[model samples]
Target chain A: MKIYHECLPCHLRTAVNSVMTMTEDESIISEVVEKCMQTASRFRSYDSLLEIYYDIQKVVKDAFPGMDPFSELKQNFNKLCMDSFDEYIKKINDSSDRFETALKLCLAGNSIDVMQGIKMNHDVLIKAIENALKQPLNKKVMEKLKSALQKSSNILFIGDNAGEIVFDRIFIDYINSEFNKAGHITYAVRGSAALNDVTIKDALMVGMDKSAKVITTGIDMPAAYLPYCSKEFNEAYDAADCIISKGQGNLEALLEENKNIFFLLKIKCNVIAKILDHKYKVDEVVIEAKTAS
Target chain B: MKIYHECLPCHLRTAVNSVMTMTEDESIISEVVEKCMQTASRFRSYDSLLEIYYDIQKVVKDAFPGMDPFSELKQNFNKLCMDSFDEYIKKINDSSDRFETALKLCLAGNSIDVMQGIKMNHDVLIKAIENALKQPLNKKVMEKLKSALQKSSNILFIGDNAGEIVFDRIFIDYINSEFNKAGHITYAVRGSAALNDVTIKDALMVGMDKSAKVITTGIDMPAAYLPYCSKEFNEAYDAADCIISKGQGNLEALLEENKNIFFLLKIKCNVIAKILDHKYKVDEVVIEAKTAS
Candidate 1:
């Protein structure tokens, strides 16, 4: 994907600092420390520390100009970036139904707060969708979706963070209005307390539950998800005719799965954006798959 | 301050989820939940749930139309506002050394990842900061900062989050550069990981230890420096000549303390912004203690 992370140092440092706070679990702390040691052992060949510092500089320079790179700005910049990122994340995360809204908010060329603070350019969105609609759909892909739906009756829609779920509502409404399927739609949310609230309660607040049956992804992120995701999401994924996975985090964990699913989200970061951009010229691309026949 | 948080439901749900993630001691989570309950009880007096919903909608719609009022966008907006605010804060954090690069970055508004795919905006921040900086500084407040520093030799700086601390480097540098102080500046980071990383390692990563005798805040945010922030920050707070706090979290925890401290941060959210706007006639206002006697 030719991914570029200009702020690896900051990210690495953040990871390490996060590890330090895990005094509650000595094993986890030791595990992280071991990873750090492994990284250091490989540092001779990789020069990871220097790479991190340079990446931090690159990211800092990209974000700000006319500043001496080698100065105390690193600390201030770190703090500012985290605070800004945290705040911006909130603006885009509007409960659970607005996952797509969150994705767009992330993609918008402003901090999360600015994008959230400002009104959505709905005209732009509607126009974009209209444009997408104008482009002739790949007959093969449409046929695949149709056949996939024919094979199964129930559908599971796995939500990403908060903002993007709003558009999910629109899609769900359209499906209900148009499709003559006998199955129900189960809307799934992230089970844990992430920066964005994608809980069942969040789903209810955004009224996604009212539109469709509500369920949790039944997994927490970064800690305890993989163990049960296969079982939890699998059931919803299995019974469903098709799955709709939204947002980067979902794509991160589910992109490789051999399932018939449609992924909806804005390619927010450079890494994923580049991959999707390569596949679909459009930055915010929707990829639909057909179950292996 | 007349604080209004319409996202209490989201907060409550998150608090619950966070509680589940906590170790055996669930006291902190219980406290946060209790507070949420108290807030809900208090708000029920002024408006019905529907009315409250509309009120939030009005503010969010005004800021970001087509954005669900109940979405995470509001929270992201709060982060942007806070990030914008830290720019000003870095200007006077330490009053010793000057972190020119950090200051420039803050002034330039190039602080965090904007998260756009390929279409990124470079001019938006310049305009936001230019407009923000064009406004006159609170003259009555500046006189107070100058006087307080004149009388104080030992300064204590309370850091809020990780990213903002980068900007704080500038403030610390300014303190070192401008002030002829005898005692050292003490930098306090959050003892534990409470959403943001402000641990000692984070303190060292940015070289804050070099600028001042680093200390942990010795208190957690909700609990006020439990086991993490060392007892030193408390001792320093008692003995240090001046104190500077960055970010809303710290301010919320410490604003009422009758101590000589300068609170620097952007007015995030409609509630705080409204209060600051009403009390000071500006969306961003720096609150400084009356000149040290």
Candidate 2:
């Protein structure tokens, strides 16, 4: 019920569109837009995002017609927005909201700006409650969620996407309504839009604060752009009640990290779909780590 | 000087826009008319064209807001058309003309209807010719091209996308002009639109008759849609001294077929890009294969 990574696309689209609007040179903008579009198109391919972007000169040319040098940075930046958004949407639409919430909780750590953003979106958060009333809760997912709710005094929830935040709120409300004795949940947003980057502002836009504590990461993480990890993310990652990872980038980064994390997302790429032994249609998924004895 | 794929977008935009007034769908028609507002939001994710029809559930929801299925489909179909046009623009603008042409050529093996659809678009082909004239020829490709022109007494040239046929014409024209010995270059097109389908009509739409012989594939092959192996295509594929294949689909179907083919296209997928060790970008790519001789 907790909406996690589903809210990512609107934020990503907003950022890219904002950048597209601000870029002054038509040729460069066009080139950059094309690069971003090409990057976006490759999401349908069965390749890693890194492999997709690897030596992407030919693809860039396909996207941008007449190109010069200065447009390269802009193109890469535009690609950042698109790549992140694609993964964010994939995760949010097809996965259990629990891991999504867990991801947000992990990011929030203790950032107040992030929390305030979630708080402001209370009205939006309630929209999910209305939707929840309409949708029959799946017995299996609900059982795991209820158990997690029972075990944790402080549950960290990761957030994704914009519109789906309303849906995510339903999960938290359900916990509060039916299991008030469980614990307080901390919601986390991305420090910046790294693949699954969700901000407190985004959390507010979708109304996350109406039911939970919210926060953000303390540093800017770029693995979302490139595949390598940084020191800051590793330390911040180590401190969490439970880490919920959203979207492909987060999943790729954390998939082998051996952390106590739950992954929730839609399998968008053939590579991931192959990994999950699923087809390309959107579907919800959830994975929880065995609690440390 | 020869206009390559670089000149394809402007030419295609003009062609599609010219007929934008004639499209049956009002919304898609209107979207085509919007000079600068095209988006990929409409047609990006469908696995097949059939899905376009089945997507009525959400169409009614978002387009009609609170409307029922019937009313929403009625309203949204119009919107869908515009969205389709938008997606077309995105595809054309973002992809290299050469690559697009290659895709179209590969598609020609899909179905005769797809081939005919390409033939129907005359306006874009004319514009493509004008654009190709503006660019200098790639010497390396041109050399191989020149040799093909001389060595082959008869040629089988594959056609690609809407705007790309003009570039194909450049090769055909050069071959005839320089060699002056071949009977004619037989241009082949797709039978359907599965991924990358081209057809004879597409060859003619770009005025293939003016420069070479036009032929249609007999069978509809999704993974390898080539009519050449058929009675109709084999006659042409066999009679021709050499064969020219365009697009990724062709490469997918033909690359390992152990046939004699000079493949012309921009490497569009990771599989090929990785094989070539080239960064994925839109550029002229010519791969030569001899039939294990």
Q: What level of docking quality does candidate 2 show?
A: incorrect
Cα lDDT of candidate 2 equals 0.43
Off by over 4 Å in 2: A1-24, A30-142, A181-183, A193-197, A219-239, A277-293, B1-293
Interface RMSD of 1: 19.8
Q: Please report how far candidate 1 places residue A249 from its true position, in Å.
A: 17
**Which tens-of-lDDT digit does each residue in B1-293 have in candidate 1?**
22233233333333334333432344443343334334333443433332332232233223333322112322342344445445555544533423333333332232221211112233454455555444444666556666676677788777755444554565566656667552477778765444343557556665677777877765433223322345666677778777776655555555556677776655544444454445543235345342344
Q: For model 1, what is the alpha-carbon lDDT of residue A92?
A: 39
Model 1 chain A poorest 10 in a row by lDDT: A109-118
The local distance difference test score of each candidate is 0.47, 0.43
Instruction: Give the proportion of true interface contacts each model preserves, from 0 to 1.
Output: 0.00, 0.00
Indicate the worst ten consecutive residues by lDDT in candidate 2 chain A. A1-10
TM-score for chain B of all predictions? 0.57, 0.49
Complex DockQ per candidate? 0.01, 0.03
